[model samples]
Target: MNLPLNRRLFMVGAAAIAVSGPAFANTTHIVEMLNRHPDNKKLRNVFSPSVLKVQPGDTITFMPTDKGHNSVSIDGMMPKGASGWKGKNSKEVSVTLDLPGIYGYKCQPHYGLGMVGVIIVEGEGMGGNLDAAKDVKQRGKAKAAFVDHWDQIKAQGLLTPPAEQ
Candidate 1:
């Protein structure tokens, strides 16, 4: 079919717009509950990949690799307007975090022994709740565990994400 130049350009533009897709796809991250660290036996009661970094709209799944453990969001750890979640013992729970910030979770049965995990949602407002979450008191080995996690975050340069061009 032959078309006028303006109509042909319009058709091409429309087709290009139609072919363009979403800016980014959301991702699902997995965290496992373990009775003992998989690589290090000396570390008992832990979450494999204790610190996870994700983008906004990503889903986090807490997998139960061992019995008697559940994932529960720590109080005062999530961003404002973000709700907390608790999974039944030995059950898997998936949460979609839309708000950008730091989320702290734990394996309830071994919380005192420091089976804690961190999920950092990178983007705008990510560090808004950081200091507050850090200030929230922790008990047992959890204190030291979280301190190490924070240090790791800083050392690894995961605290602030790369700005968009």
Candidate 2:
């Protein structure tokens, strides 16, 4: 009650801002499109951190650390109605996914070579489309790559089959 008018107004404004701020800040993840795995030279045309986990409203930026590489989402690999992205080769692309689900992506040119990655968005309803994403047909080396990704995801306890859910 003893506070000056301007000081009281300032305190009220600051309290309003604090109360309206976002509850949690979204994070940005980086994925590098590489010609060779940083840890293993024998592996070719890979996405470093091939399996990424993110939160809703988070951003994933794919950087072309090596040439002839681009990131693209597979046709049936995302939550229904979620927008997919395609990056130009040799350029960087950033996408923010607000929907919670599994996203499977690969390099357009090297898809058959198994240049693929998975993004798992964690939140309520995150597993709604997991089964559909897992059932997407993969060809060439991509088949094995996706199998490995699925296994890793399961190991992490992130992927739950519909029957179990």
Please list the residue runs of candidate 1 whose C-alpha ends up more than 4 Å from where it truly belongs after superposition. 1-22
lDDT of 2 by residue, 46-131 (tens): 99899998888999999999999999999899987799999999999999998889899999999999999999887778878879
List the pairs of residues colliding in candidate 2: none
Model 2 lDDT vs. the true structure? 0.91
What's the true lDDT of residue 25 in model 2? 70
TM-score of 2: 0.84
Root mean square deviation (Cα) for candidate 2: 4.6
Tell me the TM-score of model 1: 0.86
lDDT of each: 0.90, 0.91
Best by TM-score: 1
